[model samples]
Target: MAKKKVSKTIDDINRKIKEGKVVVVTADEMVGIVKKNGAEKAAQEVDVVTTGTFSPMCSSGAFINFGHTKPGIKASRTWLNDVPAYAGLAAVDCYMGATEPREDDPLNGVHPGQFKYGGGHVLHDLIAGKKVELRATSYGTDCYPETQVKKKITLSDLPYAMMLNPRNAYQNYNCAINLTKKTIYTYMGILKPNGGNANYATAGELSPLFNDPYYRTIGLGTRIFLGGAKGHVIAPGTQHNPNAERHENGIPLTPSGTLMVSGDMKEMDPRWVVGVSMLGYGCSLAVGLGIPIPILDAEMAEYTGVSD
Candidate 1:
């Protein structure tokens, strides 16, 4: 006997969503469906699987265009609350990284393990609607005459503010533990002496890419929940290694793929995007994100059905 094939398109799923007939379930729920009804039968009943995660994502940042200043100074250097922002683009346009440390920051000076402020905090302040001191300088040019500008700015002050992260949502990562006799501080969080504790970054069963292990349903233009706002996948994330060795079940054993996600920073919720300075690992943003996988076939259903 031949096996039955199941398939559906995104448009078909959208039409179902509009008609209030789409069968949506969390990735965790799909596990039971595949185990009981089998992937083929589960695919016939389920339409989409949703995945979510929240963790420290260092490669996150924002790009802001602060509308041309009077006298139009082409900003060659920029800083926000002592944190440097890359002003390599046009006048008044800059990019601030979440992990970039600030000048006079104790972490860079007297302090070695504890940090207080960074670009991530600056971003958080803006999202919280707090006005931050903005300082800019430029070598007066023929086209852009002003040499400098200083002022307080908020999210609403900028012409455009985009949360353009270069790399995020790592597919899978390491579980760290200290084998030595001494305590150590790491990005995965503080590890106790002699393997007394362990830390891992992934959300296990609720992670996004782990569900669509083969990238069948997620690609460029796929809509997602980013920092509490609706965002889209613009391109393959940085360090996206599709050929990484995988288990027989398709789960990668190492830190493999990553995503370069973007969305409007203005629309993001402050709660969903948090700034943090680790004990020894410096600074980064705790980003919240989610992706919905369309179970177009039995194969996709089987993949999403895998649990932690």
Candidate 2:
């Protein structure tokens, strides 16, 4: 069989952004958005904030910061106004082969893959304070591959790859996973756990829990853990379990013991929710959110940035 192409184009990048699939943005770009216009003005310009993607097992999201000054209530309101009522379903990361291969040998060159591609926008106008939270509901389908083994594996255990949509590469976010039910969770918040100047010798640093398979499943009233902290866990009552039977046709369903991994949203900066309302009012209506997005690179880059 012939090898599949691994590179993407500018158009592909734009398409993902318009769809609200891209959400991470750079600190400079985010700061520019805020500086160009107050938070509300920047918020209105956004389309879809791309959270990170998970293939069969992994994920990431865009990040942001507010500096020392807090965004005003009006700016915060504008930020809220730009967001969709219900953020789409959470997307699961899957492994895509660098090249197309026979069905019998699909995993040949596959690596950690991201759910979608595109850029993201950040809201710097919001207040910067401890325990401040940004709330937004996510909507996307989960693709679970049937398991061949009986033992459970953390998403970090699987071999995976990434595909980048160059336009929106600066986005960042903290990530979590629900193993039992096989779901990925993302949140917009401060980046202390994922960021900071803690060295290996330090003891009091916040340690993030990534790829821990013992976490709970996704269900109504299920406690969703974010970045390894109990305080970050989303209470069971906040989100509901997805119906297993009504999954999209193309998504593969893995059996029990499947390894489900999630990426941690970085804390160095503030994250953005690319608002898709500028182009249209309907959720189904697609709009390009022009921001560079990142994917899990085969070879890790010094920092996630746009490809020239």
Candidate 3:
């Protein structure tokens, strides 16, 4: 008796098949095929990696029917766990209320009695120049400590201005803040302060705080991402207030603060799904691998179609 060796070539295996030519493989075998296909090749290929760092800590909301003329809409933070951070948010379909229809309707039987559409134009209008309060805790401080230090520190008067730099994947836009009035206005323009001029004396000039190298030393707006129970506190409700609790240890202090920061967040807009998809697919092919593609802008635009 002699030992037999199996050949690995596709042609050698095909010759052994029966007349019907049916070949079944195991689960592990199929998995190996998938892994092999997914592996990156060294051949010269265009790599389309998403640029810039991504953050998932920020909160987002939406408004609809902004003006009275248009319908009102609502905005909320988008939850995209399965989608990559660089891929951005997803868009959803919206609709408006129904009205009485005319007797003579075209495509009579084919169409429904009434049509549906999205809402929230009024909500958008109401959000303009509106103040949003965000509360975050500094590390090494217990939120419910007793005998806490209480101070009414004016952030704007701290000899520097604070600016929020959102990811560039979304459209770059300008926002105006009236700290005295606690109002913020968003618009499309250069993000530079002082009305985008060379000099910095104007009301809208970039805050000098950001330029100072020593700003981080005094713990000015520095934040650490805390995971699970001990992390920063993000109270869901609209009210932004900080309260102290009595405990066995010495007085624990927690500070309550508000940010007058504003910027154009259209970069996180769901309408850009189509563009993301096209880029993802193109990049995947260029790299000779099946990369996970994000939803495209066209797809979202289709979902959030014009309101009638």
Candidate 4:
């Protein structure tokens, strides 16, 4: 018996992309397709499988480089809309990380769970074309002699605003089920007491990594849909543990691989990249990410069949 062959290659797909003749389908659409025609024939017919996932990602943030101020202030401490940002980098460069609640939040003091504003909200506001307060303090140097500077700034005002998230779009994550007696609030959202409710954070069939279990089509510099704009896989996300227990279908049983993604914050839409404040869980950004998996061969077609 002869071994089956994969008729197409990555270069072939690139040529099809150039010719605007590449076939594409959503992960959901591919399910029906592969189910009807089977993966072998599906491979012959399809060129790509698209996937999407939207969930709260705590390990998300952006880096903003505000232009040097008059007289050059070496910003030692910075805040965006009153949310503290790490300003230990260059003169006016800072990294605003989500999850840090505002210093002047007056709700959580009385109600322990009323965290309304945070770094995520500030980023959201900035992207929404809202002018946010940018305040910074310097130690007053000879070359950069400015102690304090405050101004209202928009996302466009910054020289560079890079949406560099360290970790996002977790592959196969946990299904939270509380076995205790009482409502519990967590990053996965609220879980009622004693298995009264279950919360899971994933798109299941529409998830990207599930379709390419071995990361064959996904790697460094893979293109993705980030915040409704074009983004790229910069690196394997933090805590990317791909060596996990998987089912017979090659899907992980627990949290597995992740992706570090980046895109231009200025090009992102506020609707797709949202700021969320979870009950008793601080703040996070709900990012919308999508990936297009190339169907390179029959094996990849079988893998893109969405094993779980």
Candidate 5:
């Protein structure tokens, strides 16, 4: 059998955007609206659905290229705010992963891996317009002869600052609750022992993938709001499971379709991109993303109506 498709096209959605007629609603708000008005009516009335999520995403980072200094050197080593940045790409180019730790951090000491300062913190500081010390050691080349360089720089000073998150935006995630007697520290926030309190990430009804459920509108190159900046879905994220059990409404019962998103780091706001420190565990970055779904047809409308 041939597959049924959404009648909406990218051009149709663009026209709505141009006219500012694109109807947008949080995932949570759509639930109430869908309940009050049937999916058929709601589909006709609504034009777009916007969803957002803020959670500790470990697979987040940035690739920065600091403009070469006078008497340029091939940077063999680089450090951002005392945290080692991978500078093996090219001279003055480096990638800072979210979980990279501070070398001087008291890992086994008093605070035991409590990252007071790290790559995430540095990125946060950069976004916050704070000056971060940049240090590099290089093997001097005749064409680009310089050995050592030390400078203080901000995000504004860099020629290229791009947020390159490898894996993010899980379609559906799980709520964590510790069954052990002892308290557990996890990426899903601190899990209380004996189910004292359950912690669930994602915006629930306000999550992007939760609203779409299926990969109809949201697919490769779909424009999205990432880190408070415009970004696009590049590919399926790591462990992108599409064949999960689904409810009658098409919403997945398990975690499904993830997204690999990227955007300009400079355009990101500090509010949406933040450094996070898990109490007992290592550090992570809290990333916020929002996607606008156009109501092209009844199917799109029905998809948006699926609630928490």
Candidate 6:
């Protein structure tokens, strides 16, 4: 069978956005709407659909530049609340990785570091208006005379704090199943033994890529709701698989188009961005994101109408 062709355009979507007539629906809400009103009527009435998900993504972190201290110090080593922050980029600039294990993790010997307080937790603390310890050391350069510095700082003290996540939302992913008799720990959360339970990722119909499965509306510059703040899709995320198998509606049935998203960490709320521990796996961040899919035409509405 021939592949289905999508026919929505940007200009048409923009017009709806301008007119304030866009219809937005969440994934959990789409199935009922489609069944009640039918795809045709639902599509014609809806101009935009809002999809959202809160999932743990490990490949996420933030880069922050704490303005130089008096006399300046080329920060060579740094730690935040005892969790190491990468300080090799430049003086006073550090990248706090989301999954960097806690140095003094109580569970170090028993399992992978509990990751109870990693970069993501630091970010959450910073966003919640809490103070954190900032420690750094330098080799004492002539240009930057200061060698060592230790101070308590808040997120407000930094001039720039940006979350540059390598990967965020996935277009679609598989449901994890464990074939072994024992429970398995994985990035997709815990899996039970031998069909005891199936863990599925994605927000079902309420996911951004699921709504625009073929990358029709989602691309560079598309505005998205990231980690409790407004963000944008900068590029295709790492391991983007656009050629995956698809359903009749063109939504890929396998892991597909992912997004490289970024936003100002300063504007984020602690509620939507959180640090999580996967028992035996490791630490990660559960990020919440929402995207508005514009229903540009009948075809676009039909796409939005898909459920389950």
Among these predictions, the greatest TM-score belongs to 4
**Decreasing TM-score order of the candidates:** 4, 1, 5, 6, 2, 3
TM-scores of the candidates are 0.95, 0.18, 0.15, 0.96, 0.91, 0.90
Which regions in candidate 4 have their CA more than 4 angstroms from the true location? 1-4, 106-108
TM-score between candidate 5 and the true structure:
0.91
Predictions: Cα RMSD each: 1.6, 26.5, 28.1, 1.6, 3.2, 3.7
Task: Please give, for residues 120-166, the per-residue lDDT of candidate 4 as tens digits.
Answer: 88888988899999999988999999999999999989999999999
Model 3: CA > 4 A from native: 1-53, 62-65, 70-260, 266-308
* Residue pairs with backbone atoms closer than 3 Å in model 5 (clashes): none
Candidate 1 lDDT over residue span 164-264, tens digit each: 78888888899999999988888888899999999988888889989987788788888899998988888888888888889887889898877888888
* lDDT of model number 2: 0.23
Measured with C-alpha atoms, the lDDT of residue 139 in candidate 5 is 79
lDDT over C-alpha atoms for residue 70 of model 3: 15
Query: On a 0 to 100 scale, what is the lDDT of residue 100 in model 6?
Result: 78
1-308 in candidate 3: lDDT tens per residue? 85332213323324534344434332223223323432122000111111111211122222111111112112122111111111121121111111112123221254222211111111121122222221111122233222212222222212221112211111111234333422222221113343443211111111111111111111223221111001111221122122333122211122121121222222222221111011111100000001111112222111111111
Per-residue lDDT over 1-308 for candidate 5, one digit per residue giving the tens place of the 0 to 100 score: 96354466668868987998876676777777778987767776677788888888888889999998898978888899889899899888999989887867775366334667677888888988899999999879987799999999999999999988888988888888899997777767677788898987667777788778888888889889988889988998988999999988887888887888999988889998899887667777889888988877777777887766
Better of 2 and 4 by lDDT: 4
Clashes of each: 2, 81, 40, 0, 0, 3
lDDT of 6 at 150: 92
- Using lDDT as the yardstick, the better of models 4 and 6 is 4
By how many angstroms RMSD does model 6 differ from the true structure? 3.7
